[model samples]
Target: MKILVFSMATIMKDVSMGGSQRHLRELLFHLADQGHQITVLTNRRQDNSEEYELCPGVQVLPILRFKETFPIPYDTHPFHLAHSYSLIRQYADTHDVFYIHDAQMDYGYLHANIPTVASIKNFVYPEAMISAFHTNRNYLIVSCDYMYSCIQYTVGRVQPQITDQLRIVKNGVDLSVYKPVEATRKSQLGLTDDDFVLLFPHRPEASKGIVQAFETVRELKEKLKGPLKGQLKGKARVRLLLPRHFDVHVSKETEQFYTQLTQEAKEFQVEESLVFYPWVPGHDMPQLYAIADVTLCIGQFIESFGYVQIESIACGTPVVVSNVGAQRSIVPSGYSVIKVDYGDTESTVEAIAELASTPMDITGVRQFLDQNYNYKENLLGYEELITSAGKGSSSVFSNTSLKSGSPMDVSYKLAPWCYVSGPKKGIYHDYFYTYLNQHELYSFLSTCTEESFSQMELVEAGVSSEAIEKAIEDGILVLYTP
Candidate 1:
């Protein structure tokens, strides 16, 4: 299938990246390798070269973005921007399906002329998603079980119509590229044989627990004062590997929070225990995950799916995360993974110390998780969805104008092939079946001949939108136009 993925900023990977960007980059790579003709559309400043690492063989098109105006704050969201709808509409007729990475983008506000699938990453602003339930060619994709439930709670409540269009597609990690400890982060950092590295790899935001992590470290280091059995060689002291940095798209609030964290770190006099790594190449993430004895994620916000925890576990790194959002499911208690409630400094420290005490072999950790989240398996699942979506785009509602030469044409009836036929079931499965008054419906179909349904006729029949959808799905009815 010819697929088009739309992302506002650069589709990023490797370096600490936002969840949506990472998801898109992974999807592009997986699908392109699967032989789909994929095109990535992005918004980046003018450059001499047009480069795309994620979609290696595909073309990356630069698009015009919404300009920030005075008085009104700059809308960084691409979907809400002026050109987003028009740009997407331009390509709607060409692509087989549209994969929009963000759910809150304004595109869903209008109907998609092409088969459109959107991944709802986080809690979308309600206003930005107006008319989503009624959107055409719209289908929703969720990565994890938690993500599905989160979207059901956040957006589903507002637009109940979305429930019918959702599909669960779990996130997959590339074992071939992200496999266990091929290289040591300790060796790269010049850490002595006796030092333990606790990696804090997260966005530079308060919600991400950047400061909370530092505070936890302050308390943890104090708690682990005694000798701790290191993952390697001998007794090892906890040395944190956290780079105080964020990419360009980071918010001003986040930058200020980072500054505050720096001040707090300086005040704590814990700089000696910190090891800062310079600009890390994107491909070195697996190595970084491998080097850490235990990856720390003490964020306070709700993570739809914690990718870092998955990547760390894949690299044979014991991951200890706060029991918040989807972290509990991602890093459930068992194996080498441990979860602590946010703000519980003592438990968080103890969890880390416990993992450090008895070294969990990198081989064992990798072996345990080898079958859990396979990238190829999930890629096939996505391909099935995309292909099905493209195939389903064949159906549309269309019609020709009806007229009365005598000026007495107030009557209408069902279109051709649609009739009071024998009972038809909704969807092949029984789950979507709506218990319609098939007798009344058949009577209505056989008798009604006055254009479309009048408000009175619909109300008298006690028909619902779902029943109508079920009727359409069951092939008891269909439109000449939609």
Candidate 2:
């Protein structure tokens, strides 16, 4: 099969460290190994490269239009949707099937003739679900049960027709590469055998809970000097291992963010316990995990799937994860993984302290991982779905097309998830599965009609002139014509 995969993540050292990016690369390589022809369409790196082979066979064609805005901020910039649409239009004809790594950018192939399957690897943003429900061409694939549940709650509630298009494919890890390690690189990392090392194996972003991790490290230091000191073998020293440097050139925003993080550590008086390290390549992450006493995955970031925590467990290390989002589903047995509430510094410190004396049950944890999150099973799942989707249909979208009319003559109605609710007059955007009090925008949408109406009719119907224009601009009122 000739497959075309679209991902914003480039095949670069800095970008490949992310879990979703790695998942895309692994799947492409696996399909190539099975004799399926695959070509990946991704953003060009800032350094400006055209095309390269991701593996020995799978071709990676980078879209040069994205070079200037390499890390396109989708929320702030319009290029994310525009570039995605343009890219799909340019290349959709040649490929038999389309696989998109990000559901948020799935707008491009909504009306494409070929089968398109897109994956959701983040907190189920409403825009993503809305895009999925708006089309029949795309199959919304989620990585965990939690993501599936998120969709089932919002979109599924409004549009039961989307049931056939939803799929759950669990994320997996390579056991051989991320296996148990008998020895740790303590001496090399300038740490003793006795020091309690807690690894924060994530990007140094505030959203990733870097600030909360810093506060926890400070509290851990205080605990070690008190009653918890006896639980350790030697001197009670707590080290919070953080990845400070990166392989790619740091942007001004990133540099400022890191500097602010460091400043916070100093303010908390835990600067002494903070151990900053340069970036470790993805291949060497197992070694990094093995050396830490407990890997910290606690933070404010709503994880779609906890890959770092799973990898830490597979590497024979216990993990302390925030009890939120998909982290709970990673280890159902709760064998080697410890759950703590997000922002609860005391519980986080205690979990790490408990693991100091009692080592993780590597044997049981590895068994659970092999049975559930094995990389082979993940690859095979994608293989089956893509093959079935490619052969099943020639025309993927519904027959319905927008009726051609003037801008004001286009029919507009409330989105399936959107409606006016309660005795109060307001427009609700069910994007987050909740009603928002948008009174001004509600004015026009409340008067929305399934049948076409001219602008003069809407104004004559007592709809505020400002509300009508705002509704059209915000997409609260959909139109078939420009």
Candidate 3:
């Protein structure tokens, strides 16, 4: 099957640098191995220049030109959507399926009336946006059971008609690329022969919990002083490797935090214990994971799914993650992975100290990856789903079926009718209100007619003259007004 995948950015050379890019690279390679023709659409920037060349069978097409934006980085702009629509329309003429990674591309493909399968990554979308896309029989793929549940809840609340098409496919990692490396690479990164190095290899962002990791390490170093002095004199050495962009905003804050912690270390007389490395190349990540006594991912918010945690586990490196979001699902129940409650600094510190004293079972970690997150097994599932969707039977709802009013009534019926004000001229807010008010509630009373729902309706309430129009141009909203 010829498949077109639209992604914003990817890091093919460095598996550790970004999660979405890594997923795209791994998924494309695995699919290509299965003999499917694949093409990727991404942005053209300095980092992405070598992006398409990383994979052999996969073809990379740059859709837009833009400067790099970090933290929430990408090359997607409003103009890119217009360009993508034309590109996808041309590709859809020959390609079997259009697989989209983000919402913008989903909108573009839906507008072109192309068959699409979209992976839901975020929770929020405008009601008009939902209605416009919901009419099309598109397949929605989610990463985990948790994410799938969230998508179901949100869609059910806003646009339940489209819920039937939702499917869950957990993300996977390529263990071959992430497994344990030889000690020589560790020495090259400045680790001594016997030093215990703890690595925090993520973008130095506040949300990623870099400061919390540093605090945990600081506390662990403090607690180890007396035991080291008395039991193993001259045999204790601990360091931290924080690879980050020098210009990244959080890097300055991280450096400041490191300075303050080092000062505290001096006051506590343990200053010789911590070290910092600003940025490590992506290729060296596997070695960094191998040399680390423990890898930390202390995220405060819910991760859609964590790639770093999986990457660490794949390297046979033990991980300490916060008990929030997908981290719980990503790490197996009895593996060397340890989970601490979010904001529980004391517990986090204790977990690190415990891991330092006890060695993790590397074999169990590797075994977990082999069984669950292997690239081939995961990609096969995606390939099958894409192939299935391409055959034109993958839609959960059809307009004809929805119009028949069995499942349609259940999906579209709204409880407790409410009045809507405007899809007034020049005001998008009024347009949405009027659209929901006129079509969603009134049009469903009799047999559903697309004309009645599509046309604007003028209604009078106590004090307002509201003009109701559909939110999405071709989409209809059925508001239930009592």
Candidate 4:
């Protein structure tokens, strides 16, 4: 099967945009090896001329040519959606199945008339998009039970018809890379075997709890640094591997946090407890995880399935995670995944301090990972999703359509297609059409009086404001007031 993926994930050892991209890349390579032809169209921008590091069988291309981001969020960004549509238009018809990463691109694939397998990695998918796909029942991929619940509760409110398409394919880790190993590379990393490393192998951002990590370690430095006389006792130093820049396209808010973190690290004297290394390569992650006594993955964002916890546990390291339903849902029973309140630095420090004495259960954690989070087994699940979606199976990954809960206002309606007869022409009506998409048009229609629509709507929908005025001149659409 030829799969055309419209996601910003790379199968190569290049810059990553976090877990979603990493999951896609891992699955794509494995699927490529399974004899499926894979092609990825992502936001490489310009100047991303580095070679793709995957098998020669897979093809990767950049959807956007220019570099830079729209300052606003995705909900109102027409420019970003236009770029997505341009990419979808380029290859939507040619592929056997469309695998989309986010709900913002639903309009692109819906019109393409192809079977789609979309991942609802977050709970933020709009009701308009969810309702749009009610007729076709596209496969909505979810990574964990947490996100599955989120989709059920949120989208189910606006569209009760939305639940049937949802499916769970739990996140996986390459256990081979994450398993415990001798620190042959310890000295090379400028560390002794005796150092009590507390790794936070993620981007240096506020939501990632970098601020908390610095504060927690700084507070616990004096307590953990004493010379010990035990089986694994050395000068207890907390070495943190924090990436300088995040792998994804971050806004100024996160950029400000990043800038502030670097400056305050010295002020907080975080270096005393945690040795901060910036931008460590992915290959070195296993060693870091193995060497560390405790790892902090206290991200504030609601993670559908956090890779840090999975990888840490797989590497036989105990982790301190955000106290939330999302991260908690993935942890196996009897496994100690320490939870800390979102911004409670004192609680986080206590968790770390408590974990400093407990030994990592390498055998047990690996068993948990193998049983649940192994890449090969979960890749098969993904392959099944693609093949089943291609076969048009209503029986997706789950045995039944999902259930629902909380009310999320994903309020937008798409305009229905209309037929105007004047010697029937193409798929569309005989003459001029509205500039806005169904969601945008209906939203405008909601705000406008019954007698008239606004020129701003037309401009927002990619038509110039003058287009409506010109259309009125050409007798395309009559212009009047309510």
- TM-score quality measure for candidate 4: 0.71
Candidate 3 residue runs with Cα over 4 Å from true position: 10-16, 47-54, 71-81, 88-90, 102-104, 108-111, 121-137, 161-163, 227-235, 245-284, 396-482
TM-score of each: 0.71, 0.77, 0.69, 0.71
Candidate 2 on 36-107: residue-level lDDT in tens? 888777766555366777677688877634433323335344665576567676777888888877654555
lDDT of 1 by residue, 259-371 (tens): 67768778876667777665354356777776677888877666667777877877778778876656657544566888865666777877887776756665765555556
> Lowest lDDT 10-mer window, candidate 1?
425-434
Candidates, ranked, lDDT? 2, 4, 1, 3
> Which segments of model 4 are wrong by more than 4 Å?
9-15, 47-53, 65-84, 102-104, 108-111, 124-137, 225-236, 246-257, 271-274, 278-281, 394-482
Off by over 4 Å in 1: 12-16, 46-57, 66-80, 106-111, 124-137, 182-190, 226-236, 244-257, 278-282, 361-368, 393-482
Candidate 4 at residue 444, lDDT?
41
Clashing pairs in 2: none
User: lDDT of all predictions, in order shown?
Assistant: 0.59, 0.69, 0.58, 0.59
Q: Sorted by TM-score, highest first, which candidate order results?
A: 2, 4, 1, 3
1 versus 2: better TM-score goes to: 2
Q: Write the per-residue lDDT of candidate 3 for residues 1-482, one digit (tens) a residue.
A: 88877764433354424665556676777878878888776655554455455466778776544324343432347675566566656766778787766443444443354567776554433422343355453677767765654444445445555557777777777666777887566655667766667777766456677667667656666655864442212336667776645434433555665566556656655456555565554445687787787788876655667777778867767778876556656676667778876556777766666665665677877777777766676677777777787787765574322223332122322211112223321111211222233343343333343333222222221111222233222222333211
